[model samples]
Target: MKILVFCGFIFFLAIFPLSGAGFELKTVIDQVSRQVVVPAAPQRVIALAPSITEIIFALEQENRLKGVTAYSDFPKKALKLPKVGSYVYLDLERIVSLKPDLCIAIKDGNPKEAVDKLESIGIPVYAVNPKNIETVINTVVEIGGLLNASKKADALAKNMRHRIKRVEALIAKTDLRPGIFFQIGIAPIVSVGTDTFIHELIIKAGGRNLAEGPVSYPRFSREQVLALAPDIIIITSMARSVVFEQVKAEWNKWPNMPAVKTGRIFLEDSNLFDRPTPRLVDGLELLLKLIHPELINEANKCL
Candidate 1:
């Protein structure tokens, strides 16, 4: 009986560690499907999006970042990191060579096949989808928790929330709300509708999106745009040398449009406005300044 009991005890001991091995679980957003992501925290991390890279830096996990996408230019130091190619077209071989324990990617920007390939090769991938400013804050906190930087993430999230709340409070007190049209891309005449982060920013910045007919980004006819009669037109400042004067010259062709007639067209930093990151507040402040110039001083106070 003693011998049998001793064998059983040994077996129990053999399995005990396996049974109780602690594994951290983290919730994130899957950019492709635009859903919540819950994955194990990765140690050797590679970020596939510039916005994600910014969030990682904000979380102070720069040392953990092994690789970043080609376009991650902010923080200046990120430019020195290993390039994993663009999110849309990643260099799989380079990524594989990096031997990252875990990879972070935007589900929309990073192909699902690439994520699957990495997983097949025994690498973990966390997909992030921050669709709005609030979601951006939550994503930061979640990523921080996953990366063992929960305290910093919490602090960042709190600060972001406070800033957003302050904006909301100020907007609530004002009776004036401008109708805004956000141009996503110009050549094809793409505009953000209700389903995009930019759309959320428009609302947060105390403006109503005039591109309400479409649920997502859509290319509309110039006549349709003119009919919308937006009070303000916000062109994303992309490409080298944003020429508001050139844009205004084009808008002048549509003499009857409110945005054109009132000369409420403005250009905003595309990186800040389009990328869902901590700097979105800066984009909001910019919009607020354009909509209500008087509030610039107060917005600066909130910042």
Candidate 2:
């Protein structure tokens, strides 16, 4: 199996000199609460998740990124970097071949075995777990600290906080919480629940998530969705425009549904809604516009 070969290669590397031996070392607690000994100034770093790649780029520390996992296609320039495979299925051999001084990982997406194997081979792997918008901002600051770009990180966090407060200020004007059904999966009719970033965005953007529950992502039947009578329906997709149009057409069949009657169904970029990056603030703003267009329109008139 590929996993077996990867483990064997890791074992082979473990007997050699530690990779970060000559560097200045510092002990710090990662976001996952694990104490890791990392280089005082890591020069060659590998980002284990797309979100991590975006964060590094946002902090203007992309020069230090030696590698990134696949699908880190944001910022356009990241497409030129070497890939260490997908976040869920990491290519440990390729990662080791990059000769990185550090590896930044995501606790939610990166496989635990891969982290353990990389650490076992004496590679410092600092992991971050950003569960919400606030933690995501903290993640930016923490990663900035690691990369020695603290000032940029602080400025970025301040900007995000300021934008969030502006949204809150506008939302305070109205108590209307439109019922929203956000579709992420087309075939299965999947929607996010309370624990997900999408749910938090929906709630914070002054929309009520009809799928709010214990389940992270819940599937819906056509009848069930019809029963919810959502005021707005937003679909997140990376598919072709035709596919989205087709999906929209399917939803448009129910004339009696509130969303269908008002023509409030919309399609959104999946990355903005799902990724835990600085752009999540953009997602929140987008949601607010869709959910409370009246408020935004009114605010614009005052300008």
Highest-scoring model, lDDT:
2
The sequence of per-residue lDDT tens digits that candidate 2 reaches over residues 1-303 is: 777876776776677634556889999999989999998899999999999999999999999999999999898999999999999999888898787889999999999999998898889999999999999999999999999999999999999999999999999999999999999999989999999999999988999999999999999999999999999999988885977899989998889999999999999898998899999999999999999999999999999
Model 1 global lDDT (CA atoms, 0 to 1):
0.76
Number of colliding residue pairs in model 1: 2
Cα shift from native, residue 211, model 1 (Å): 0.5
Go through the candidates in order and give the C-alpha RMSD of each one to the true structure.
Answer: 9.7, 1.9
Q: List the residue pairs that clash in candidate 1.
A: 28-37, 32-107
RMSD of 2: 1.9
Per-candidate Cα lDDT values, in order, are: 0.76, 0.93
Alpha-carbon TM-score of each model against the true structure? 0.81, 0.95
lDDT over C-alpha atoms for residue 136 of model 1:
81
- Report the Cα lDDT for residue 286, model 1: 75
Candidate 1 lDDT, tens digit per residue, 13-127? 3454211234355444444553333336556678988988999998889988889998899899999999988989887667765656667777567888987766554456777
Runs of candidate 1 with Cα error greater than 4 angstroms are 1-43, 240-243, 254-256, 297-303
